[model samples]
Target chain A: MTVPTGQCCAPIAREPLAEDTAAELAVMLKAVADPVRLRLLSMIGSHAGGEACVCDLTDAFDLTAPTISHHLKVLRTAGLIDGERRGTWVYYRIIPEAVNKLGALFAPLTEPSPGPVPQPVAGRSELGLLPA
Target chain B: MTVPTGQCCAPIAREPLAEDTAAELAVMLKAVADPVRLRLLSMIGSHAGGEACVCDLTDAFDLTAPTISHHLKVLRTAGLIDGERRGTWVYYRIIPEAVNKLGALFAPLTEPSPGPVPQPVAGRSELGLLPA
Candidate 1:
């Protein structure tokens, strides 16, 4: 049987979510739900090269390399990160499309155009909650 | 002392995220991060009313009413959802501004205006990986 690897996640925006999509998103969110993962993402983003080696990560955090490796794997499986090995260390960086998709998903829901009459801000504000 | 409620979270888009913002987004993401909460957002959005009641939510899921209440509470605390007690049951809906802010943060970084006319997608693509 094929193990469910990265197939579960997709970009959050640009498509209507099926039930499977929700579950997939939940899984990705679960991967980043931990405090360690958040810190990892932050540190990686702030790194000069836009990526960081596991060796550097190990020195910054109190956790062991294996634990850091585990968190990085979680970020990788979630599509939030991509890692490459260089000699003695592995480096990881954020995946842009993944981040973009996630951003789009949480973006206010948009609706197809209705009547052609342009509405005012008040109407838009009221209608905004309606996902149009 | 005041409760550490909504102040903790801010939008993910724009600006260099201070350490506080990470924790805030983490909390907000933590809210919708749950499978049940995801379903709740779906059902609420698909609802004709653009809102949902605890009664409706309880009937939709297999979990007990109290469990549903707890989940809703979690969502509210995370600022991913807002609720109002109307009559006997409370109604909840998604907060667009909060969501918009979250979306913006995850959005690809944009560097200040610099250099000459825009380059092709290839340069943008390579630079895209680098937050320019």
Candidate 2:
């Protein structure tokens, strides 16, 4: 229930994330943590029109349609994907904002850092800024 | 026990991830899905020398030392972190390769995509390349 209300916290490599921020990200991360859900997201994101119908998605998995539907529901609850019923078939698409937020959360880890290790500043408050 | 053996796969937004690739990423993502573990990773990643001693990390949470240790063990098992015993304290550091891999996995989602939605080329095999 403690979902991130704003932009994702600064990347983990940049500074220690606040407890609440970590909790928010953990929820979304947990949503994509399962194999089936991760694949479902991928397929939806890469499909034509940046979306996939329920019929198309079920073929890629060994799971039953009901099981795939359940996984899609989980992704929807986590805000990773959005589903819309268009006539006879329901379609799903990746929520780019949600996916981008997760990418930003991990961005610092991918970039190289320059120079020596930072000195430990003691007793820093919650708002303390990491040295640049 | 499935894992990405070499580099991580192309981003999900770029193309549909192969089944084996999704399985590998899911395992690593599951490892970081917990709030406590995510916080632990952030702390180690941002700490001095890009590492943190167990003593320093324990004070940051209300959880007991053993619980913290267990979480650290999970991170280590997932290849997100490495710990070394230095005399009285155990120090943990983020594994940049692992962290970077996760970031790269999600990069396409963050960047803007050009033009219209991609066409679904029918009967494409596993090696089909995404349009550039």
| Candidate number achieving the greatest TM-score relative to the actual structure | 2
The DockQ assigned to candidate 1 is: 0.19
The per-candidate TM-score of the B chain, in the order shown, comes to 0.66, 0.76
- Superposed model 2: Cα runs more than 4 Å off: A1-5, A109-132, B1-6, B109-132
TM-score for predicted model 2 compared with the true structure: 0.81
Who wins the lDDT comparison? Answer: 2
**CAPRI docking class of candidate 1:** incorrect
Local error of candidate 2 at B116, Å?
A: 21
lDDT of 2 at B85: 89
Interface RMSD of each: 9.9, 8.6
Estimate how well candidate 2 is docked, as a DockQ score.
Answer: 0.33
- Give the number of the best model, judged by DockQ: 2
Q: Please provide TM-scores, in order, for all candidate models, with all chains considered together.
A: 0.68, 0.81
Candidate 1 ranges beyond 4 A from true positions: A1-17, A110-132, B1-17, B110-132
* Candidate 1 clashing pairs, residues 3+ apart or interchain: B12-B105, B13-B104, B13-B105
On the 0 to 100 scale, the lDDT of residue B13 in model 1 is 22
